[model samples]
Target: MTISTTSTIAADAADAMPPLYGLKVLDFTRVLAGPFCTAMLADAGAEVIKVEPFEGDDYRQMGLQVDGHSANFAFVNRGKRSVRLNLKQAGARDVIARLAGWADVVIENFKPGVADRLGIGYGALSALNPGLVYCSISGFGQSGPWAEQPAYDTVIQALSGLMDVTGDPAGAPTLVGESVADVAAGMFASWGVMAALWQRERTGRGRYLDVAMYDCLLSMMPTLVSRVMAGAPATRQGNRHANSAPFGAFHAADGLFVLAVANNRLFAKLAEVLGQPALASAPEFATNQDRKRQEAALARLIEDWASALPVQEAVRRLTEAGVPAAPVLSVAATVASDNAQARGLVVRQRPASGPAMCHVEQPVRFDAMPRGQTSAAPALGADTLAVLEALGFDAGAVNAMQQQGVI
Candidate 1:
């Protein structure tokens, strides 16, 4: 297998405009899913204005904090200006109206009907700006029987059948290490916004997008979805591919390494590397399905060979022989690896105050679009005064609103 590190592209355009340079986004997302969606737009050069409640986003108080900043909040809320508004306050509606009129896009992740109650729903805002693209992220879709029920990442994972297909077959169903459901919803929400934006360019009218975590997560599991649709039940198979043998982690002398042999040709190569080429032609291991039936025996043979070699050596031998293989690595090791550095996967951003922060950036590469211009996440309501003033609130009105706890 060849790994090409570079691609040819045309030179930058004369304007040097960022992908979403002139876009205006009003972000009402607080936690992972909605915040993550808006954050992607901000990274693509949209001018994102994040509106928060007086108490601020819940994530700011939920995760690891350093220098009075939450890592979780910073990771998802970076590159946006923040404004605080008490939506329950009567005076705040005026500000929301002005913001709605000013924004090209608005995204929220409140439970269904909550945004309507707070006057930030699609019907309310789109009325102010008919060209606005409004997106709602939720656990279940709007208008569903379970739409109003509150859900977190774990709840969505469990409900989506993702948890049911993760972990070891012998063990109980387990949650994924990361918040896959939330991330899936965020990704789909961003895609929906972009698609709506493209459509609005032609129609001269905006669209309302409804994104559900459960739906997005379900769509992400192609293998399990196919199996279940074909009359097979979903079941956990640990770190292995459910339908393939010799395609999971195997123990080495020092640690574990994963291998993939998806077809007879790859299995022949793997068998050759193990000095057991005859196994490839054996009736019990002749085809992928046959090998799967004898998976336990196959694993024993491979593990017996690998158990005497270090993981790196085993991985190197397998890779040299052209069988897909890799040593198991921890998160820290993977982030600090040479590949991550060479690809510029992790980036550092410095806020106006506090120590610099490091995060993994979006992986897409555009030849003409420059990357690595990220700023740190804003402090809660840091731009409140400036934003209100920009929306035509004079000093006196701003002061009175603040005094009355409206902002």
Candidate 2:
């Protein structure tokens, strides 16, 4: 079997879209994980329809509500249409089943059994729509003992040892500033979706995906899990690699920045640049292992040395010396960066009032067509009628369905 990217319409179809133009996605995931996955798909030219319960996504209420919707919600949900549907309500399940039959993909983030209870599980969805790529995002795998437990990003970070690996070594272990688990899970889910889409072209069938936020975070555990597997207990080492020395952030004379000396060669170069070349050969810092053993003394020596030169000067000297170095950038500094502008990393759109919407570009770039943007996130149920009408529902039917709380 082969999955082909052929069009249902004629060649040079004038009313055409970009790649994935004919793909249709039904998004049932809420908050961060599911929404982000669908957003990426939508940005790639998929017709992603986000199905929210009549009460709408919790993200619509939480966080910063702007223009009658959450700013964060708007950021993730731009370029997608909203169709309000209460899956638990009478008449709603059939509508979703219909949507599933028409869709190429179905994304949901309910807990393990929640979808099955609602008759929207992958088993049911795939049965209704054989070609459906059903993606289930959760805290754990479907059959695990911990599958039923609820998990947020903070909990996931803690469970996956990411928390233990963050923060200052002496300070209490802390969660990364952002929701690392949700973001990673969303990215992994998107990866799975694209993989399934590619395979579907060959097999003429789709597969069910199980993405756990906890597992996603664990997959990104850096050296923590591997080291433990190799006989090292996970320990909290703030701002430092658990195994590498002189591979951490240091305070330079004027400011702070990171210096990642991945291997002994870089460490030796770093030492030489700091005018302490002898220390690179000193018994205490002779090798990565020995340097780790004398981490306190090594840090003291490096700090004392770096405290002499200005941060930019130190960075320029090290960079010129072929060392990996970077200045720590605050949010404001990042927003104003020339690199940010030159790379087109941020997209600024004009509005009549208030500040123009400054959006971060989708991280992925294709050598072909660049990304396109729609107006900001929809108002609650903003595209309800238009999307439904496109889906073959009459205006009267949609209004009645909304009144019955089946939307």
Predicted model with the maximum lDDT: 1
Candidate 1 lowest-lDDT run of ten? 1-10
Candidate 2 residues 337-399, lDDT tens each?
A: 998777777665543333344556457665555544544455566566666665577877777
lDDT tens per residue, model 1, 265-309: 999999999998998889998888898888989899989999999
**Candidate 2 deviation (Cα RMSD):** 4.2
lDDT of each: 0.87, 0.77
Off by over 4 Å in 1: 1-16
Best model number under TM-score: 1
Model 2 alpha-carbon drift over 4 Å, by segment:
1-18, 280-284, 349-358, 372-375
- The C-alpha TM-scores of every prediction are 0.95, 0.88
